[model samples]
Target: MLRFFFSFLFVQIFLCQTSIAQTDWSKQLDHYISKRDEIDAVKKKTIKNLLKDLQSTREEKNRDKEFIALMQSVKAYEYFVYDSAFKYAQSANRLAYQLNDKSKIAESKSKLSLIMLLKGLYTSSIDTLNTVEYQYLSNEKRKEFYSTAYRAYYDLSGYSRDKHYSEAYKKLGHFYSQKLIDEFKEPSFEKLLGLALQSMVTGKLNQAEDYYIELLNQFNLNNHETAIVTSGLGFIYSDKGEVEKAKEYLMQASIADIKSSTKETTACRSLAEIFYKEVEIEKAYQYILLAKADADFYGSEQRKFEISYILPLIESARFRKENKQKKMFGLIGVLVLVFSLVILRQLQKLRQARKEIVRSNQNLIHVNEMLREASQIKEEYIGYYFNFSSQYIDKLEDFKKSISRQLITKSYDNIEQELKKYNSKKERQRLFEDFDRIFLKLFPDFVQRFNQLFDEKDRIRLKDELSLNTDLRIFALIRIGVNDSEKIAGILNLSVNTIYTYKTKIRNRSIYPNEEFDLKVMAIKSV
Candidate 1:
């Protein structure tokens, strides 16, 4: 009886201790979850303290103290803010080099490699890792080196996705990960994580799941660790086609990441992909945009690349769905509107008949006014044409009389001079001047309105109001409805090519585009 009681007590104590341990982790998780919204503020406060310490250490001019300060700042910023983390890591590296400390240099470079990996600089991360001398690194530094190298290769393998290169990258990743695992004792977080990742890479989903579950059970993880573990479970479930379970784990991981202010993460992106495949477009779009924002904030090119494929697909699907809904609503509205209009039409049949008679009378009156205005314009132009013809006839008669007098006197020089005075070029110039004057009289604001189409520097300025330049003349023809290049060229006594050239050059110089310029010219009101 005594032995049995002792055994029962021992069992009870062990169970209680186990329950307390699990409860502790649960409380920590709850605490972070509650403070998710305040994570950024908390991070800022922590960084502020770190900077204060850094400044004090810098003022002391002790290289070792400053180095430690910079490394602390780097660690503080690594998961939340990569740019600052990278800057501090770089400063630490330069200081290490300056101090001629091989161990510090190796440690700093390893930290830099991890930051580079976070920043999607995979090749640079690998290159940076290669520069570190393993012999000079302490055990802890070696662990970091192996871890960075492992992640760099693993991520590079996935990013490539090409069978040829991916296989080689995967092998290197396995090599480094195994090295990392060996650096740790058994049942450690680092060892378990490495084993889980290896199982995942090797296509042992069940084994990977077991490893992750063991990690969760054996450890009271912080926010970062929780994010990592949950994210792994999310991927495993996703691969196993357990969509609901995948989403649950991914959501928890994403929430934890947010609580920790971890911008460099895959949780949000994984959630987006799963939602996208589930055809929950709104959820997918929201998560993808969130993922993109985090990637942009983290400055991770790899994350951006991963998102690029899904984001556009989600946006397009969303647009198509919205357009479909809009079209359906529009069809329904049209049907209702048509039904209403038909009812209204039946009730107002007699009233509409009366309105039609009144509307016809109004349209007839408007047409009469337009015809009267057209007749008046015709009369003015015709009267002006007859008077101009009479004046030209008189001038011709005068020219004939002068020529006859020259011939009778046998003054060949005077005849030659008279012929030269009546040359085609001079006659054409006079004709153009007359046309310009008459056109301007008919539309007084044509030049002013045409100038408005161009910028101040490009506007055409006439030497005199009585004449137009070639460009202005071409547009003037267009304003008068002589839009065809051949017709305008015939009127201006120019080749069709020259007319087209002038039109193109003027339109190119205008503030309006080519297609709109002609329309704008035609829009000019006629007096």
Candidate 2:
């Protein structure tokens, strides 16, 4: 049966069997609301509303498989956050791949790369964007891909710490000359926002203002787009030294931007930055602090850096002086150093002792692991023995009974004793293959789930090459409490070498390449 996925026409929707199911968005919303006292902030509040919107549409016209997968992608992205935006982006990228939607793949990868740049992972961001750069697609789809890539590269260059801004400038130029205008001709709320931000980055204040104004007219009065566009325009004006005009727009932008759960952080941050320039110190500090807290919560490296660049200026000089004075306490310092040295010597001795104890513990642990594996193997062996013995014993008992009944022969009493021995053997033999069926059933899914970590290219390269072969499988099983590699080998009908080969292949596929098999095992331990 061909299963249909009914995911209401999200960009880059794809059909696949292993579609992820969307959770009840309302349930999540209520869950957070129930915990409302514990959750407070513009960003979090926005997340809440985003959840509501997604849920609201669940009962709408298009409820299908594709939509569910997209929801899962969104949920997962929100759930597992990091200091870098790249991680969420990567997950979304994988979600796209699973769906077989090329547009989604590009969007996810591009967004992740963009976040990475904001988080100071410039090289990695650039590498990711380049690796997934789109070359063959429809005109609209192609524009989406390059536009994302353009922003990613541009942001990456700006955060590079190195002085080469040429890459960023060039990408910015390309975005302005091509992607921005093209997207504007047929604006998506999401893409429109990006273009507005891009306009500002390229220093095209007039163009930015134009885009913002156009967006304002296009968006519904109270929507996320209105506030985002308004705030963006305010920033542009502020950048060009038009403080009064900037403040006016931002103050107005705040109403829509702050109200919508989708765009409060950027709105708040922009407002804060403008207020600071106006030297509304207390008010400025309040908004900046709000922005800082929001950024930290979301792991927004971009926001963190924005705060960091200006932190020293506003820092209390009195605290600095006090710290300097404390550092100059020479007598106290010498006394502390002496104590520290003594503690260090003691710690070193303690560490050496601990190492000895750990070594002993490790040996004991290894023995225990071996025992557990042996136990499982013993079970399997018993099962096999009982399976064969039960049939054999039954046949033997029947033979004796048949002979006695036919001939009225002597030693009929001995038949019962022989039957008892056979029964005992059968009972012992019944234990093997107890888990074999179950284990085999779970193995396929295990492969799929673990492989899900990689993108299509990674999976294809790894799978076709038989990269995560037997050795890695052995250890992986061990990691999950399957200790008997020999039993595993028996099940696989191959020697231990086959298992070792699998390990080598998996390690080679890793970001850190390893040639030493022993070291690879040690590394897997850490991973």
Candidate 3:
């Protein structure tokens, strides 16, 4: 009975030990699964070459050895492609079974369980792991099995709505998580990856980010490992609401996944959703398209479902925005055209106003010239009138003195002769000569300018240079304001009828109107 009790205690301790070494399998797998598309081209080539070498080998032992190497190669693609990984793992399992190798069998089963878990078949993954007997597994194989089992239960707990089953799975997953930590005897890349993922699962984002940063900086990581670290950083920053930083890390992870030929990266899709929310439609379309292609290539139902929800929304928004911009531009073009026409109309009006201003200025200049000419004519006439009046007054005074002298001396006959000299025809002739000289002095070009108004045949010519013709005398008198026909006839010792006839002839010969002829004559001035 004591032996039975000790055996039971030992079994309990062994069971506890197994639980302690198990990890959060879902998160560990997800870290690499999100970068499944990112596979190194060179490594793929090398694996193909190894497979070619395996096919060419004739010996069974050589084929088995190559199969082991091929298994390692296919393990690289396990998280990337479920069916391909399953096939390779099955081949490796068969090869190990033929060799009676328990360690190799356990390793292949652990790998198969990981693929099953990635497909989200948690119960199937746990069942596959249970088929491997833990007591016979190598340390590494045992750790892998426990890791796969823990991830399966953790996922089950997360999806469970029932409180009792959820709590039970959670407690089981926690025990496996602690075991995964305790089992790592030394620091390693795998250990760091497990720690980072476990932190993320527990909502310890800060610790997760720190662990991922360390993995990136201190270690020479594989393409898959690099993608995992970068993607985790993106998730942490995204949760913290640092969108720009999150996008940067997510883009890096996405690129690495593509380069490494990873089959399942959600970083691109996450960025697409974020850009859509921010109204960056074009960016959303670009990222979502790449994600859609990836999901199509992956042939994964979950990825297809997630992308379906947001793709149409972003595309519709982009179309609406483009149409709105086109209409807005059309309106702006119409407004600009209308504004241009208005400006042209205003310019034309301004030019017309300027032309009118120029014409008005020209009219004002012509009026000013006419006023100046009139002012000059008045000044010349004023001097001439005063001199002529003074000479006439002196002649009258001399005549009066001569008549009185003749009366005092009793020379009636002499007085008569003297009076004739002073006031008769000869005296009138002298007075006319005096008037002509004064008028000619005042208006030297008067005859020539006046003749310019008439036809060549009608122009007046004087008989003597010192005397005026009847017609010349009439117009010359009019020029100096002796305008009345009677006054002009008396001054020139002619009849009013003759004077009227002469004035009529001059007016008829003039270029101007009959009424304006006299005025034009008066307007004439000295050269």
In order of appearance, the predictions have TM-scores of 0.57, 0.44, 0.51
The Cα error of candidate 1 at residue 146, in Å, is 1.7
Stretches of candidate 1 off by over 4 Å are 1-37, 331-527
Which stretches of model 2 miss by more than 4 angstroms?
1-104, 114-120, 133-147, 157-164, 172-177, 180-202, 221-223, 252-257, 262-267, 315-527
What digit string (tens of lDDT, one per residue) describes model 2 on residues 418-508? 5555554443333223333333333434444444444556553334222244443465454333323465566556676776576556656
User: Who is ahead in lDDT, 1 or 3?
Assistant: 1
Candidate 1 lDDT over 1-527, as tens digits, reads: 99999999999998677556434543554566467558878888999999999999999999999999999999999987777888789789879988999989889988988998898767667877877887788777787688778778877888785699898998998998888776666556777787888888889999999999999999989988999999999999999998777777787787788888888889878887887887778877777887888788878767776776667677666656665665565566577885655544443664465456556546655665675586588558757878988998998999999999999999999999998887777877887887788778767788999999999999889989878888888888777645446778898998999987888788899999765676678668766
Which window of 10 residues has the lowest lDDT sum in candidate 1? Answer: 21-30
In model 1, residue pairs whose N, Cα or C atoms come closer than 3 Å (at least 3 residues apart or on different chains), thus clashing, are none
Runs off by more than 4 Å, candidate 3: 1-44, 57-63, 134-143, 159-167, 329-527
Superior by TM-score: candidate 1 or candidate 2: 1
Which order, best to worst by lDDT? Answer: 1, 3, 2
Q: Write the per-residue lDDT of candidate 3 for residues 1-527, one digit (tens) a residue.
A: 99999999999898566534222322333455455444445656766786675565525557567556657756766655655565667667767776777777777777777776776556657766767766677667666666666667777787677789887987777676667678767666656766776677678999989999999999998776787788889889989998767777777776667667776667778878877988978878887887888767655545665676677667666766765765565566568886655555555665576566556646655665665586577567667768878987998899889889889999999988986675477767776787777677678888888888898888878877677766787888777645446777888878999998987777887888874565567569753
